[model samples]
Target: MTRFDIPAPDAAAHAAALERLDALVKPVGALGRLEELAAWLCAASGQVPPPPIERPRVVVFAGDHGVSRLSAYPREVTAAMVRVFLAGKSGVNVLAREVGAGVRVLDIAVDDDLSDVPAEVRAWKVRRGSGSIEAEDALEPGEAARAFEAGRRVADAEVDDGADLLIPGDMGIGNTAVAAALVAAALGVPAEEVVGTGTGVDEAGRARKVAVVRAAVERAGERVSDPFELLTALGSACAAATAGFLVQGAVRGVPVVLDGVFSAAAAVVAAEIAPEAVRWWLAGHRSTEPSQAVALKALGLTPIVDLGLRLGEGSGAVQAIPTLRAARAIIADMGLLADLG
Candidate 1:
């Protein structure tokens, strides 16, 4: 049971940012969502006309689920994708490059040895793979706490090293199922409503995923009221880690851009752990997954964009970085109407 001392965003700064946006040369309310983004930035950073997003960082938590048979892809794909991310060849890499954000991949619970890979990548691993949620707890007795601490350490390190904005990504086969189950348990929703065609699962695959989510949710039962207990019962090491990363990011007063359903599900758990942390997060995009919208609604967050993005590896959030930069620039560089007079 980790306690997070997350401070609420600066209300005065938010008001000052809105005043500045209204005083801009453009007509009032002309910038639409951009104005909202600028104000959020001000509140998150606790500064009027917040500093530039110079060093955005993406942390991809890679793992494997014992219930990955429900996924369209094999569990080995998680490790393979981690390698691709490390090689700077994934979709997130391309998008992160476009936004000048550095990417780091951690093997939180990959089933593979990854012996040849860099040691730093596997430094935070909790286990080979999480247990199958439908039949067993996702983590052992204390593994969930360890994984959560690993995520918090990662966020603290990134923020200490000058990461201005954080994007927590996911890389795990069958993680969508894990995410859906977690969200269903958190929101008391039916599995059918939370389940989606993750990784292009066929109709049969989706049905199987829904069944697995239902079973996991049922198994979780009363644990849904306790964030850590819910994560241990239904979430992978990656999910728990992501939840911790998000919470620590807000605790450190760093703004985060959440990715798809995977991140969104973790966010629901994070919000449960620290309700004030929601103010430091921005929904980067609306994922095609229905569970994402449900989780976002629970958090009272509106997505900045809706490009139908379902890719999970922080691709959607990375793509939205430019828009965040534009928002910051509008506040920092735009001429004020009062200046003209």
Candidate 2:
């Protein structure tokens, strides 16, 4: 296991940024979430005014789940969406292009034979898809650790290539069900409270999903404090990989903006493994899923938007990038009140 010597973000820098923010011509908290967003950037990068994100990279880790067959959507949608992302036709691609950001799609565990994926976008495949947690562990033996490391390596390489900001997106049919199970087990909550109508399932489907999650949690035995074990037992390969990416983002001092419930569930595992990593994270948007809220609260993050978005594939996070850039502009260009005199 690669040891992550992640440090907490500098509190002094955050305080300094807040001090500067209070001196801006606008009234205190007038900018609302933007102020908080800017301050978080400062703290995250240890800069009084964080540098504008020049190379914002959105990486969608695509996988499949054995549980997808149980959901309303076809299991093949996961692979289909990977192709959409690669073609820059998905919501994430559209939003990234509009914000001057780049998108990379990873065929980490998609069930389709994505050998035709262009070299620039393809990543190592851990497997075709994870097992159904309703009956057994999601990953094969040793696969969990490998998935975790895959995520960390991808984040590290992106940062090495000068990516200033990272948005981890997910693409996997029935992933929300896996995420809901992880969240409920981690937080010791009931599945009914955490499970939502993923992909707009009908009431019967929703009830079935909830029951599946509850059974998975119960079958997993006692919740272990070890994050890797939790991931192997309850999370998809993409979820475990996402957790690894998030942990390494903080270790490398790069800020990470997390997308909806799947990302949030991975974040819960990341925080469990390294509590300090949470300091470098920002919630991009609030997903309509109740579990998303629970995961964010567990991480002590306030999301930048709340348009009831439940779309995964990093769409919600990518949509918030313009606002993030605007926040930077506000902190950097707003005149001081004293100067206004």
Maximum-lDDT candidate: 1
- In order, the Cα lDDT scores of the candidates are 0.92, 0.88
Q: Which residue ranges in model 2 land beyond 4 Å of their true spot?
A: 1-3, 119-123
Candidate 2 lDDT by residue in tens digits, 1-341: 45669877879989999999999998998998888888888888789788988999998999999789767789888888888887889998988898888998888888888767776555568988888998988988788789888999999999999999999999999898999998999988899999999899989998999999999999887844567788888888899889989999999999899999999999998888878888888999999998999999988888888888888989899878888998888899999999974
Prediction-by-prediction clash tally:
0, 0
RMSD of each: 1.1, 1.4
Candidate 1 error regions (>4 Å)? none
Tens digits of per-residue lDDT for model 1, 1-341: 55678888999999999999999999999999999999999988889899989999999999999889987788899889988998999999988998899999999999999998999998899999989999999998788778988999999999999999999999999888898998999999999999999999899989998989898888888978998899899998999899989999999999999999999999999898888889899999999999999999999999888899888899999888889989999999999999896
TM-score computed on alpha carbons, candidate 2: 0.96
